[model samples]
Target: MACSLCIGTVLPILRRMRRLAVLLLLVLPHGASRGLEREAFEVYHQRRRAVSEAHPDGLILLLGYERQEAQAVRSPFRQENNFYYLTGWNEPGAALLLIPAQGDGSVYQELLFLPPDDPSHEKWHGPRAAPDDADIRSQTGFESVLPISKLATRLSRAAKKRSHVYTLFPHRAGEGKQPEPDRREKLQTHAGELPIADIRAQLEAMRAVKSEGEIRLIRKAVDASIAAHIEAWQEIEAGLYEYQILGPMLAAMINGGCLRPAYAPIIGSGPNSTALHYTAGRRRLEPGEVVVMDVGGEYAHYAADLTRTVPVDGVFTERQREIYDLVLYVQRKVIAAVKPGETLRGLTHKAKRYFDEAGRDAAGEAMGASFLHGVGHSVGLGVHDPIDFSQPLKAGMVITIEPGLYLPEEDLGVRIEDMVLVTENGAQLLSKGLPKEADEIEKLMRGR
Candidate 1:
């Protein structure tokens, strides 16, 4: 009788426990529970290995962005570019540690530190992956995963043996509030004497050259941006407000599977075109004026940048065609010169020379004077991916060739931009799908 009563009581308790477990699983963030989207595991693994090999004498530490309370209502969260480049982890409050092989024959080590899941916060913001998750290591492609709370302990322990710690140091003036600074503070607190070296330069060099996988993602971004431009051509008309054109382009990008634009879509019409970074889309496009639509899309963290200048009406005026042709000529000339061993600064100088020799604008000033900004910039995770301007171009480097002449006096601005992939022999036009020729753009706008 006593054994039967004990069994009956334990049965109800076990059932209640099972019910609670099921409820907890259901409330866990979907992305955390099932693993968020990421590239192939090997891709990140190789990247981490490269960084480790670069700094074998020190410990490499990288911290991701912290969770923002306002982001829930204000904007979506984006992982830090460098951290994302190495680990491909999109979650906030994550850090990566890589230990190089010691001369004593100790093997290299890699660890991913993740924040513990907050069930209460998850109720409001959705499920988040915790370090304790059964599949956390597999999900993150890390051999070892630990709670973020243990980061200080690990750093302290590693610092005892290492002479230096390699991490991103803030070089920009206004970057004090970023993750790098926070990580630096932690290092100071935990490992007082260990020197902290900047790992940004190495990362920048690595990022300047596009890997095959990165190129593929960039191609996707370019294709989506091209499609967006095509949608704009179909929808744009003289009577429409500038903002109206932005909607269709953005819609097309989203439809093409892009998360967002690489940058703010610059929908500059008429005089607004003279402003290089103009984004005000409130103006009504006029029949005789030209509009410069500088837009691109971001896909899977990669970015594409493209610019097209077209007449608000179906055809460009005589003056418009003259300036447009000149810009196109310069852009093509620069792009043709894109090959290994050619430097970006050298290319810009070449483009400027073309603009100067092309002719004078309506104001009698040299056309080159109106060509503001560099001919192009590297494009990758960031639209203007960081690179040394003087560094020689290499195969697999993706850059933009944008040549423009903005004349505020004539309310005329022409910028012809295209994404180019540096090839083993020459250059490949990634934005070839989008028509940039004045005649071709006119035909598309005319619904031909």
Candidate 2:
């Protein structure tokens, strides 16, 4: 412990010693364009800039992440996707600052502070930023990039003139550390780690409506998911185990440019399907049994979430048909309900009514124990992207309407999901190629 503290204290001086030589090599190859990464990064910067300007007073956004555990052990921190979105620095222990466009153009107005590299450290782990990580600055287009220790100083200054700090830091916002009140030197918060509800309004207000570019990326994500699902279904057979289907499906996603799984690939067979959050790898599929797969792929880091429950063989059993049709009908009705003004919570209540109404006619006492979970959730960087908790939907919103009916006793669950985009005409289904109709799915299963 004593040696660790000595190293930490001495590192700053060591970093300064190497700063001059490193600064001279500031310019690198300058060709780090990774296709979709570059595109998404551009959109992310523009929107973050807009958020700063929208509030005018300035926003202090704090974001965090967790890492994939290393070969011996996975690291606890995976950089928050949003933080990676704006800054493109995947390292943990980093923060970004977007100072409302300077009254006069200056270098450090909108900046990013990241952990600087150390040779002794990198030798133990891996490469990190040098004293001159201008490539990071150039790629992210931030005004400047500096060490993270400077953040409180930066915030202290911004709070002097501006009055609020908008952040995506707290997981369940409005509950943690609310900013200290200083009407004389006010600080606003977006996701109020509250006691300071002062900044919550702008946080929800900005992220609720998707921009045109955001919608385009989400559409691409949906298209990739459709391709993955179709591929998963095409290889399906009664003898194949449920988890076997996930490999190829996810293959299509990676090849199709979905860099990450929207969440986990849930390829559930038999009663396993009844477990809503099943993470795959299980039971063999029987001829007449239904398979419920809730899978999603991330394209340009935006999520494409979809769920489809289908027969393992070429046809559905009579009992399967009854529940499948009911699920499809309710899902269709819910899709129709996704206009430009429905709150997910409100729409969920409406969907629950349909499920209950159907129960009244068919199963009667089932929904309580059987049809567990909500209709669906918001999808984005973190699968359930944080945005708009208290507002009505707008045009660019992308949502999934999946109304499922699960019967564990009978060993069946039917859920058909499609990602829909809110449009001027109504809703546009982005996963059109997956063939959800009973006839279409059965025929596809039959190999015709």
Candidate models: Cα lDDT each: 0.82, 0.65
TM-score on alpha carbons, each prediction: 0.88, 0.75
The list of candidate 1 runs beyond 4 A from truth reads 1-37, 69-73, 171-183
Per-residue lDDT of 1-448 in model 2, one digit per residue for the tens?
9999989757654553354234223312221121145345566677666666676655545543423321124322335555655555656556677767556553225667777777887797788664267587664566577777676676665565555566642334342122222321222333232122244345445555666766777877787778778777776776677777776676666666666666668888888767777775678888778889888877665788899988888688888888888888878888888877777777777777887776553455745345566676666555666555445777777777888877777778888888777787678887777788888888877772
What TM-score does candidate 2 get on C-alpha atoms? 0.75
- Per-residue lDDT for 398 in model 2? 72
Error of 1 at 281 (Å): 1.9
Highest TM-score model number: 1
Candidate 1 Cα RMSD after full superposition onto the native fold (Å): 14.5
> In angstroms, how far off is 164's CA in candidate 2?
5.7
